[model samples]
Target: MPGCFINYRTGDGEHVATLIDRELKQRFGSGEVFRASRSIDAGQDYVRALDAAVRRCEVLVAIIGPAWLDSPHRSGGDGRALDDPDDWTRREIATALSLGTPVIPILFDGAARLRPADLPEDMRGLARCQNRRLHHRSAESDLADIIEAVEVAAPRLGDMGEDESSEGDSGQSSGGGVANTMRDVSGGTVAQSREFHGVNGISGRTGDMVFGNSGPVNTGTGPQYNGSTVHNGTGDQIGVQRVHGSRNGGESR
Candidate 1:
């Protein structure tokens, strides 16, 4: 399996990091993932270690939260408390874009809520990639989605040889297959969530289905449903807003 570089907000960074690490360990015997918490050494070397980890990875999964934008690194304010471009998560996003790596923008909080000016220009370039949503308080389902995305983005040789459940040697299974352990702030888990496969272009949960592809295939079919698929109190589609992932429970989409 290829190493993964996770780009997420500090606030929710630990939660997302934990989920990714668990899945990686399950699949590759705990040696594959370069998680910041466990991989980083003490002192000044830690910063360099993180940068090295980012460079070594093939796929960059950015766990986007509402605070993604307005980063201090981009603003040049706060008396330059953090180093230039250091605090800027956008810089990492830009690096991924520049490297032409497969960038998966996992929508935690709604990305649509951001105005164009509020976001890093590179993130706005996401006008075309596949965007996934992890509903409020739904960590387990989100964890499953993360594993699925990893399978799509970074699969190892052993993974090809065995079944999906075998992908996780951790003894955790998603029913008959591998399982993802996720819990919200309240520690409650969510059932299966909807996900799109092989489709290019944008697929977000903001308001209505907003997507378009310039390629031969048109994946602009609109929102996909899983469960009840009923309208909310206002009679609007229920799964519109982009709820973020957290140790605390997420909103039911």
Candidate 2:
């Protein structure tokens, strides 16, 4: 069962739903996050699967994009798809709300906050839910905020690593510890240490090693061979001896 269910319209917030699913899956395990396109298996009843997921999930994220409120219904004869009861997006959110599941409204791609007048009677309560904003330029930070909110809403979903958990708890800006390091440096030079060791040789005809800005560049010492070798390392040469053996004990020459 999923702890988080992503509810989104096909044409309005599908991309944002995918992004949220991926990020949540990474923080929580993949099994803990649900999205229709990826979570529903082939030949399965999609309606049943969606309803079950919504009922079981601890949180339902409703990704509302610019077109979400005014998108046309699939039936091609509607004022807006959200007003239609058969619409999956509307149904999923309605189910979550009815089941007392925490519903999170995510505003994306210049979407404005929801207004009660814009939604049907059943969905008007969604306008009262606090909303989060996500923009292309600040996606990382926005995602961090959403994750923190989810963690708070569902403490049972608290399996993130220590570093990430701390980041979420502190309400720190994105980039994790790297952002903290940059913030702490006032005027003096800040440096980070890193050492790369290879058990075997690191050699190639044409290869490049890249490092981030925080650390000094240092490549390990090793011997270079024209062709790929079993091991490439700096060491004393040991004597090589040849042994004569016979296959199946047939003969030796």
Candidate 3:
């Protein structure tokens, strides 16, 4: 069963919905999130599939973009899409509300807070529920907040998410702590800390350094030097030299 259902308008909030689905699937498991585009199979009765998914989901996220409230109706009517009784976005939200599922309103891309007057009668209650904001500049933090909220609302899903996370972390060495493997180090050092728990390994190249580690591993990169001399801690001398074409160079003391 899906732990969360994403309700979003096709042309208005679809992108945001996809983002939410991807993030949630990463945090929770793939089976825990239900998005119409991915969850519904070809030749399946879409209506029935949507209804079943909505009913079974523990939480419903209503992705409201700037144009969501006033988008054109599917039937080419002049009124807003939400005003139409047949609008899938409207129906999905209504069904989730009727089922007493926790409906979370996610304001996206500078969308304003929902007002009761702007919603159809059935969806007016959505305005009363607390909302979370997702902006491009603050997406990471916002996503974290959404995940935390979901964890609190559905503890079972939370447990499963944690398990999956731990499994990815376990691929790193035992002594490695959680850290950001990807960072900008153009001018100075960037320190990152991350907690790992799962079987996923870190493998990537940033600048001149290449990292491929399985098991808990902490790595860092700093300024490279060519034929530089340095004093050892015990008053000894050491020389550092970089081979022109090689990633690793020999050091002599």
C-alpha lDDT values of all predictions:
0.53, 0.71, 0.73
Q: What tens-digit string does per-residue lDDT give for candidate 3 at 110-156? A: 89898999999999889988889999999999999988878777788
In candidate 2 the C-alpha lDDT for residue 185 amounts to 24
Better of 1 and 2 by TM-score: 2
* Residue-level lDDT tens digits of model 1 in 109-150: 565444445444655654455766766588678767776776
lDDT of 3 at 72: 92
- CA RMSD (A), model 3: 11.0
Model 1 regions more than 4 Å off:
71-84, 109-117, 157-253
Candidate 3 TM-score to native: 0.66
RMSD of each: 22.3, 12.4, 11.0
Lowest lDDT block of 10, candidate 2: 243-252
Write down the worst ten-residue block by lDDT for model 3.
244-253
Against the hidden reference, what TM-scores do the models get? Answer: 0.52, 0.66, 0.66
